[model samples]
Target: MMNHPVSPNAPTASRAIGPTEFRAAMGQFASGLTVVASLDASGNPVGLACQSFSSLSLDPQLVLVCIGKGSTSWPRIARTGRFSVSILAADQQEVCAALGSRGPDKFQTIPWIATAHGTVRIDGALAAIDCRIHDIYEAGDHLVVIGKVLDLATRQDGDPLLFFRSAFAKGLAA
Candidate 1:
């Protein structure tokens, strides 16, 4: 076998990875959209749309969501130590767009109800999960927020909203 000579100017894996390239690559993976919400210091609801939620454990019932460090809602949610995850339904694209945007009074145009745990749950969601912050770890540009599930509720029937290739889609086909 012949060995290939390495060029000093050749790009390495790290050097080849840029924000746009990395985002485009990751966008290929389809993910469910969720709105993670909590009450602010003044008892007002605050939340942001997240596509990085995942179930971490079953025995103790745990879930995880990644929040950008620059997100304004994260700080308020962190301070509360409790939050709710609303799994968006197929028709809830408007809800996702609203929450994901940067502005004040995100909840103004959306319908929601507050849980006993002081977190807001979006109406007509596929499912709503209430959790208390279990752990937090720093990931490169975001924080991995692990939550201990407290209570959860599901709609009788509905299709889920999905994100793929940087756009929203209905649930996958059977």
Candidate 2:
């Protein structure tokens, strides 16, 4: 038998190596999908589909989403000072695609209700979270936006949609 060397810090053989290489690797980690939306100062709505939403802390009622620096919606969201996160249900794929597009009139095709806080909330979403901008920090090519949840509402029943490995999938029961 031949001897093999392994570094202690080396990842398990099952782990894919390198960011670019691992990007192409198989195996899907399902994420709850959402549309992060806001209305500009002029009351025009802007939003984008994001699977990066995460619960950060309970004490402060904090939530986080990673927005690409190059995203058009980020600049618009930054200006608003507040935003609404609408957790997407499985049937809301059309709403997701519409908001994810590049260009104007992204909100034209969707039905939404604006919160008193001035954030646009997409209709039929699994849940809606209204937040005020807490902190924004630079993280690689993305900005990690931290929000302080001001209000939250949820629908009693709905199957959540999921995004995994660049494809649309269904959420599993918790």
Candidate 3:
């Protein structure tokens, strides 16, 4: 057998990394939980919990969230061209689970109100940001959605809900 040269920073893989391993490895990086929501064609709220959200640009006030192609909410958000991201508070674990779970009307159980922009905002979140869809790009099995921020609100208090190693946690000072 011959050895293959690999970068020191890259994981040693005899074969292609499977989804489980990829997910596990990526989970080492802690991320804040967010609920990306929008109204469907029929004017009903739809949303999903996501960790792949981040600020992209300051000049245009741009942010982005990666939505899986399989997500039911993404289609609605794409059609509506508007969305709101609710950064979950550390106490809102139930809200995270509710929106993340499958085969249920997530909004039916969670407390949310429609914003003036026609997107749903999760109540009692750490912060809520309303945005209009700026652009979208296909990336592997997910779509990277860029948003232009329109309006935002924040509560002065509360820690953010964080995800790491496939579990939820509250941030703490070292």
Candidate 4:
């Protein structure tokens, strides 16, 4: 690698932006929404709307999602050692909102299916990625969960629900 001298005009205050500014800046980049779903000890469903799902390592079939530490649902799902990431379809904003908030009956308001492996999957989602817990790391206000993919399938064909700015968005051009 060739080394180049740092430009004298390089900006140094880029790291000083507040969270609000950072959030607003990040909002310009579109991202797909997903529900991280799992079953509890009694076979009841638990889930949370997660926007941070991404493919990590192709060789080991790994994926990752960052869950907020304040989320009430993640703890229950983490305990199960297995979960499914259901990529929300364009028509599932209600499903996203219901699972995103703190509630005892999130599953009661959403249409979902129970997997044979005991994970919960959203009904009519664009896709489902079932995984086993591989590792976890605490990062500031969130937990970075690494999952080893056991199975995955495309559930339906449609545009995925997206989150931009501070709201849910849909209908991206094909």
Give the number of the best model, judged by lDDT. Answer: 1
lDDT by residue (1-174, candidate 4, tens digit) is: 999998999976767789999899988888999999999999899999999999999999999999999988898999999999999998999999888888779888788888887899898999999999999999999999999999888954688898888788865679
Prediction 1 global C-alpha lDDT = 0.94
* Candidate 4 Cα outliers beyond 4 Å, as residue runs: 1-4, 7-15
lDDT digits (tens) for residues 27-114 of candidate 1: 9999999999998889999999999999999989999999999999899989999999999999999999999999989999899989
Clash count, one per candidate: 0, 0, 0, 0
How far residue 111's Cα lies from its native spot in candidate 4, in Å, is 1.5
Better of 1 and 4 by lDDT: 1
What TM-score does candidate 2 reach?
0.85
TM-score to true structure, per model: 0.90, 0.85, 0.89, 0.90
Clashing pairs in 1: none
Alpha-carbon RMSD of each model: 4.5, 5.5, 4.9, 2.0
Distance from true location, Cα of 138 in model 1, Å = 0.5
Candidate 3 Cα errors over 4 Å, as ranges: 1-15
lDDT of 3 by residue, 90-134 (tens): 989999998998755877778998999989899999999999999
Off by over 4 Å in 1: 1-15
Runs off by more than 4 Å, candidate 2: 1-20, 25-27, 171-174
